[model samples]
Target chain A: MPKIAVVTSAFFIASLISVPMGPTSVHLLLPGIVGVLLGPAAFLSIAVGLILQCFLFQFGGITALGANALMMGVPALICAALFRVLQNGDRRRVVWSGALAGGLGTALAAIFLALFLATAGDNFFAVAKLALAAHVPVVIIETLVSAMVVSFLFRVKPELLSLPRREDAVAVKEKLEAEAKESESSS
Target chain B: MNTALSWPESLLVLAVLLAPLLLPLLYFILYRRGRREGLVAPIVSLAEMAGGDSFFHRWHTGLKVGCLLITCFLFVTLRTIPGCLAGLAIAALAVTVSGLSWRRSLARLAAMSGFLTLLIVMLPFSGVMQADEKSFSLAFLPAALPLRLSGLHTASLIVFKAMAIALLMEPMLATASLAATLRGFRQIGVPVALTQMILLCHRYIFVFQQEAARMWRGMRVRGFTARGDWASLTAIGNFLGMLFVSSFERTQRVYEAMLCRGFTGEMPEIGSEPIKRHDIGKAVFWLILAVAPLVAERFLHDFTQFFHK
Candidate 1:
């Protein structure tokens, strides 16, 4: 339970520290990509990064840390998974996926905040409704911001469109080539 | 004494009026000359400088929490009009004396508070303007519910006023804490991931602004002035679409780099000290300074009533 508290605290802090409006919104994509590239371990690392942020910056409240981490971190993980699925697909699709993920992540965070507030003894439905309504403008703003970050990355570094190359791909190719050479020698 | 406005209410109004003017004066006197340090540092320093060792020695975490709780209680009970103004003043003073320069601290506070005030003032007006009213097409008209403006029911008006004030307070508090977090992080050794995130976001703000500018140029070039709704939507959509694509690619690369650097499961700390005694003392002193006006206002109200009687 203590470990959970610490983990949640770290996650919450990282999420909040990254929450401010800036170029870091793109960083939201990092966790997801990292997760896809490196697996679940990346998610834990991202959470740690987020927690470190909270500790250093006090961006998110200690009480609400768990929710914040899940809110931001979950989307990042989802985006990374989606990126992996579409790694071999068109760049346009990748861009759209990222945009959707970014927008959804922000909207989800707002919703989570509302839910957390409600459960913490505030008027649940009313707070949720108000929070949802209030966040429309913010979501729209973030969506646009997210989209821009995606496009900027696309223009400058197209290679970033793909996941980091897996070592298995090269190894498999080399093994196939060696097999072919052995067959030719036997014949 | 007329029961129309509470003592806290009147004090809050005065604080609202005075904070803008007083904070700037505080900033100019203490922080304007400091070249290297940012705005918040000087005000905090001044607070410590003013109170000396006593300010630094007394450290009670509970007191700081208590002050915050009191501020929140005042907010919920009194609503935004008075409670928020008072809270803002207190928070500003607290921040100023927390070892930050007056200029940076005041500027930070003012920017945050000012944005909140503007949003509160504008939201209602904007809502009213955007409302599907047959009359008064101007966006400047009030958008408040009819039950609020009828002036016939005094109690209803009070309730409406209180609700509006409370609504205003929530966002203001959020913004204040957000600013504090940003400042606090910089003071401590910020983590690499966090720092990277902030830098990327900051950079993209300029990137988006440039995108908007280019869209405007395109509009001008095509002989399509932004005079109509169609043009406005076109310009906005184009800019948004372009921005999304760019940011997506950026994230992909940032991730690849993180993986290369052995970013395993946690952001290792670069090391940071806990809040210093002086910082806490300064925070408390300013907290008291913020509350002083409220106490004074209560006394003044009684004094005025007694003299008048």
Candidate 2:
């Protein structure tokens, strides 16, 4: 539960990091990374963030809050599933899968946004298409960014990804034994 | 040959389009200046909005939230342009009664301006023109292209409806502190776990944002600019990885502290006073306001029927 809180905080912080996209800078939602980290809890985290965004910045209005939540939250959940399927034992494969899930998560979100707008009526088809088209670059950037982040975490902390590595377990056991021996000797 | 708007017409269109964006900017300046001169204490955080002794703040949050939700749904149900205009008026009245400023109300509208503008601009061009509908063309545009007048009406109605609901949101949710608001949600049947998560996340967002800012400054000093290139993406990835790594470590420490302090996976309830009779009366008042648009639209329906006869 505390992990949920901390990961939610990280999600917000990631959004603060704006990656330049042409003349304008765009904040990466980082939903994919969040999904991979939090698994099913990603929806809860995204909903919390959206609720805060609605109240604090008023980006998504209250009436549309549920719709916004559904759009983003659903994508994050899907990203979690995608990550699970894409990941294998190979470190390089883990990075690729994470990157793919990140990019696909964004693409799916754009689709959801389009679908939400299209619900307005047939008159919104063009606008929906435009919105979807606009997100293409975002998807690319998020994929690249997620790939790098995943690789870095893989190197520094394999535990985050719950990698099944015998070496890491042995290292932890050895360290614990060393600590135990030292405490016993001192006593 | 395509018919085109004269300079005056084009300018008028531009002015009409820019009004939503510009009006907010205008009032934002005046509001800030007034705040600086002590019109009211400047907002430190969104939760602080519940601090004032206004009627909205004093009212039962559950009732307030329920009424506002109903009001928003009613706003969406308004079909006619005049009906939506009335809805907007009701929203304005609500804002005034709640003692919120033009800055806040207009800021809500501004947040929605981009999408609303897109809908307004594209709907006319996107939809098929009926025989009764009117359309006009601009110079250099294809003759086959038509801008349906009916589409414009629906689009603007959407704009008015959206504005009405957006304007009401702050007074609805922000009239109570975060805890009280969540408690209201709890009263209205939001799950306890969800509320706890929301409260926890909201608190941690502020903490982590400061840490992120500090780290971002360090990166800036090292000459990192988000150029959207490969190097920048790699740097941002590493940065996020580091942040998450720290967060995971913090998670363990935070959990340990909570466990040590006797956490049982349940947060104590954020207590709220029982709903008063006057709170019910206020709810009824809001209910009436919510139905006002529907009633007016009915009257409009009859008047049009009579005129057509």
Candidate 3:
């Protein structure tokens, strides 16, 4: 229960801190940063964060919430996976990986947005193209921000990056100990 | 070939289509610059209003949510101007039935004015093959830039569809407690664990926001202001790192506390009333009301065809 509460709270609070990008309604959606920090749990966090955004902030509608979640959550999950594969504990490597993940996530989301719009009909193809074009600056901005956030976390709290591995080791250890105790009792 | 709109038409388009969305931007700027109220004001306000007692508040969360879902489908798929207008009227009717003020509902639309404004301004110029006759090629511009009238019409339609749903959301979302709403989601076949997580996440968001704000304030006192430099970026990054470290440790403690209280893998269900028959009836009635525009559009189109015959 506490695990559920804390993970949910961290991501939700993270999303609540959205900074509106100048004249446009496009706000900073920090899915990449959340993904880098939360690891495998990034998808769940993104989905929950989006739901909160839909209901509270009116950032997206309830009906389209699932599509929005899929768009944002998939990138976060991919970012988490990429971080795990790419990082070798070097600060520069982690920063680069974070930047890549952040930019990639936004780009994929823009594509997803276009695809959703395209589903409206053939006439929306142009609008979809424009949407993707508009997100280019967002991609760059997110890359910079994600890099900073990931680098900072790596330097200050390297443990966050390796949480999944740590948990897996603990679980394996617990299973091994239990198996050994059972064998001894049988003997 | 004649695509140019006179000055009067351009002005009319700007006034009728583009102006209303600016009000919310004004509100957003005032809020951001004035009280420094932090970012959670909108979230907090909607959450508070969801607990209000009204007709909508009386309906079961599941029923209201179900209706909202249907309305979304209907509005998003709707293609005609009259259909979209009908959808907006239905949304307004729902808001009235919920006993919420039009002003409050409009304010909800206002929150999204920024987004709507963007669509109105950008979609016409998105480079879709414009219907030549319908293009609003402005004569006033030296280059005679053609604003695709069809694109503008589509953008307007999309905005109206969005506004209709946006207005309807207040009744659907704000009319119940968050717990019941989550429970409704669960009842509607969403995983129990997922709903539980959403609730937990919502509670923690407030917790973490306060902590983050305090830390931010502390940094400010120490002369930290974000600038476009590596130092500023690094400082911001460190702040985020510290926040994660502190929060991660807190999660461990929170978990330990839960275990001490005899928590297992599953959360205990929060109390909610069973769905009554009337709840189902109410949901169906509202569903019909919400989808009336689609039906009206189909009938109206056929009706017009019969006249031509």
Candidate 4:
């Protein structure tokens, strides 16, 4: 099991650096994308990368590291799940999924932040409203970016698309089929 | 003790203003200390590409978005009834003409308007309760401390104060966040190639989401639903793993393709034309506009004191 401290720190750094940008937003998206394709292990890798960025750049506040991590990480996880559900050969679907995921992810982060602020005795509704408002444009920008990237992937490397899905399924299928064929031949 | 403003009031105002500036500094100095260990080789080409005009355009868009929030805060604080009405009209117009999906916008507008109205209505009620003249003391607190206030007026004052503080803080925070990101990038010596890669990654999030959605619809048609079993969990696991691998591989291929196109590490420079003297003058003009009211209010009270003497 990965240490909670490491994961928390990684999330803190990623949120600080990633949350400010319009498109090409980083942090949880990277880990989320990684986790989607690479399994839960990828979370650790991305988390490490985030930790690196945070320490070097001082982007996100340490006090809010756990909250930040949960914000970005949870969304990334959702996006990954969405990617799985929406995985198809169609380019448009990929784009839409990515866009929706980006927007939803951002909104979720904003809500989480708002709630955190509220619990801290900041006016809950006001803070949440502000966060949601600030994130609207960001979600739009991220959506566009997500669509473009997914489209690009579809065009160039179709095999990479199948890798994560293929890892567990294809192997089992092939092995099972091979065993069946061997038994038939013996019979 | 001789200051024109009471000490507590001054302290409150200072605390509100200082929050934005101090928060980022704290983030940088303390939180960033442990982040340097995973520094990868800076991808120079990616950085160069990201430095281009397109990248800056995105940054500019972000700045404008920040400005919009500031405008909202200002509108809330400078609550001239006409201004508020005008803002409501504009929001209505935006709802009608934005050419985007109306459902979300309408929902947001309704929520915001409702909240504002609620706050407005509740103020008088709260005010009545808090206006009682009373003296109270908590353990370990000074017994002579006076805490007299009208609830409604105080609530109204707080609402306006919060709006004012937000107006002042929003832009500052946006600028600080942006500057910090840029400075951090520069300081860490991120390679141009990596910068470009990062930008591309940012861009593709939207792209892949659409792709994912289509895939999901197809799966739904094929009768795949999670009914809380091991199979569902496995299916979910596979889906996530696949998305990540695909995205990463796609990024690698993108780099390869860029290499084939004679990609250099320099992004095209993009900025609004050099700041015109008029623009600077206008900015200065706004700064004065923002400060003038407060300054006048201060001096007018002093002038009244002098005349009375």
Provide all candidates' interface root-mean-square deviations.
12.8, 4.9, 3.2, 14.7
Over B222-299, each residue of candidate 2 has an lDDT whose tens digit, in order, gives 887667578887888898898898888877888888888888898766454898899999889879878987898887
Candidate number 3, chain A TM-score? 0.77
- Tens-digit lDDT track for model 4 on B55-77? 12233333333333344444445
> What share of the reference contacts survives in each candidate?
0.01, 0.70, 0.54, 0.00
Candidate 3: segments with Cα more than 4 A from true spot: A1-5, A18-27, A118-126, A163-187, B1-3, B23-42, B101-107, B127-133, B142-144, B302-309
The ten-residue window of minimal lDDT in model 3 chain B covers B300-309
Query: For residues A44-93, could you state the per-residue lDDT of candidate 3 as single tens digits?
Result: 77777777777766677777788998989888888878878988766799
- What DockQ does predicted model 4 obtain? 0.04
Give a tens-digit lDDT track for model 3, residues B1-309: 445668898677767667756667655555445655443343464566665677688888877777787787889888777889889888888788787655556566777786677778767665546343455666555435567666677787878898888888778777777788877777778888778877777777778888888887887789876554567656765666676778788999888887898888778876877788988888888887877888887878764342222
Total clashing pairs in model 3: 2
Alpha carbon lDDT at B206, candidate 2:
71
lDDT of each: 0.41, 0.77, 0.73, 0.41
Instruction: Score chain B of each candidate by TM-score.
Output: 0.41, 0.85, 0.86, 0.39
TM-score of the second chain in candidate 3? 0.86
lDDT of model 1 at position A80: 63
DockQ-superior candidate, 1 or 2 = 2
